[model samples]
Target: MSEKSENLVEIRHLKEYFNVNVGFFRSKPLKAVDDVSFSIKKGETLGLVGESGCGKTTVGRTILNLYKPTSGEIIYDGKPIKTKNDIREFRKKATMVFQDPYSSLNPRMTVSDIIAEPLDIHKMSPSKEARRERILELMGYVGLNSEHASRYAHEFSGGQRQRIGIARALAIDPEFIVCDEPVSALDVSIQAQVINMFDELQEKLGLTYLFIAHDLLVVRHISDRIAVMYLGKMVELADAKEIYDHPQHPYSKSLLSAVPVPDPKTARSNKRIVLSGDIPSPLNAPSGCPFRTRCAHATKKCAESMPELKEISSGHFAACHIL
Candidate 1:
């Protein structure tokens, strides 16, 4: 469990589709996450990245069963998470840090009550005294003091509120956490602090993370490996440094090229890659390859069939007909 040798979570051909009404008495499936697959190893951080509406968030939600999968399998720690009891048990081992701190927390409840919600639901504490002690401990883990316990969520700043949310997620002693844009709503200065705290907590608690975010710099900093999504499908996955340095997929390359280089000389030398077309609606996605419509390297073969995500180099994968 200490070493990142075995996978802690595995998603197999996962699909999540919502029915959207198109016309009178007519509906079509909006494939939010379509046939996606990847894994996160024990004690590893796997960054999931893509533009908005690319289904990265949907994939994270689907993994935790917050939104049930339309099809495909979710395996956690080598076991299928299918039965109600299985899901219940899985919740104890896994939790989520939602995107927005303001919306996720209850303004009505005190910080202590909010942090203790998971402990209360699962009956983790034996007595009222034990619960009080545990609440303080959890708050301390996230850098909140005991005096802040009586304060409601709205009284605190966004960063502190997010810290409370993190404290809540850690309440159940979870082994895995799906951080759905956890720092996206925070101030740029505060974001580094929270991200660093996440790293520290992961080291202390032996936690694995499926960190869903669009900020390439953030993802690059926190992830050991990264997965890129286009439309509703996964286009590339590789070691974080490798993907940033040498993205193979057309969509992946376009994404990496758009990341701003901090060095003035490097920034001047960098050629910006701009895609031609807007992202197609999921309801009316292009045939075959999901990225084909915007990909400059797309050929007739790309439109005829979707490319399988296959290993190109050791531990690096990409889906492209041209490759």
Candidate 2:
């Protein structure tokens, strides 16, 4: 979270494939994340947006080493992360804020206990008094008071539960955080507050985030750069404004067009590009480009060979045969 210009985290050819059983003794590999590569700079927010089952969450989890990637290297601070010791060291510097707050927190434990769990595991504080102080500090940082710390997770509202989750993630003072749809489950009004809190917390703590969400509007607001995924492959990646204004890939263009324009004039002028066909199963994904099945611009070449994610413009990247 320091003001370092160097890349904080680098994922190279990251792949996460799950084995799916078909026949009595036969099982095929489901490529959840297929040859994906990206990097997050220090103190920058990288937004990852995609439809359900596009491997957005899988990328985040795999980066955290929670789900062991089938292949590829994860480099952090110039160190290649492999083995349990490396992952454990990485955990001290990296953390994740889950999407569902209700299911994330333990119902039996109090807020203080839940927040202090990381500190306890890491042995951050030597004394009980020091641990209490750290827990209180985290609560206050997330806009929770000391009185609320004694209460259980079930007692809080949806937004408040997420705040608790945020507090817990911050407890370890991690530099990089994977915010997995932190505000998606919250109400519209509460979403703004929580989003603002995340923004504020980032600035104050000098934190970096891989902000993953389904809502393009929310992602655009918080992310410095945006990456689009379709069927376990990254189709587009560029600056947030550039992606919004001039999306290159067919899938990327379709996604940006789907974001509802507020103004009547703009809304009327804009045409929504609705994609046909359902997302294919990762277990039986297309041979070439994974999105070729749904992409209108797909051709014989698209089905015959896969397209690599190449830079179309400065700092703008997309994977497609056509521009």
Best by lDDT: 1
Per-prediction TM-score to the true structure, in the order listed: 0.98, 0.98
* Prediction 1 global C-alpha lDDT: 0.94
lDDT of 2 at 141: 91
Q: Write the per-residue lDDT of candidate 2 for residues 94-171, one digit (tens) a residue.
A: 999999999999999999999988888888889989999999999999998799989999999999999999999999
Candidate 1: tens digits of C-alpha lDDT, residues 104-157: 999899999999999999989999999999999999999998999999999999
User: What are the runs in model 2 whose C-alpha is more than 4 Å off?
Assistant: 1-5
Give lDDT: candidate 1, residue 277: 77
C-alpha lDDT score of every prediction, in listed order: 0.94, 0.93
Where is model 1 poorest over a 10-residue stretch in terms of lDDT?
1-10
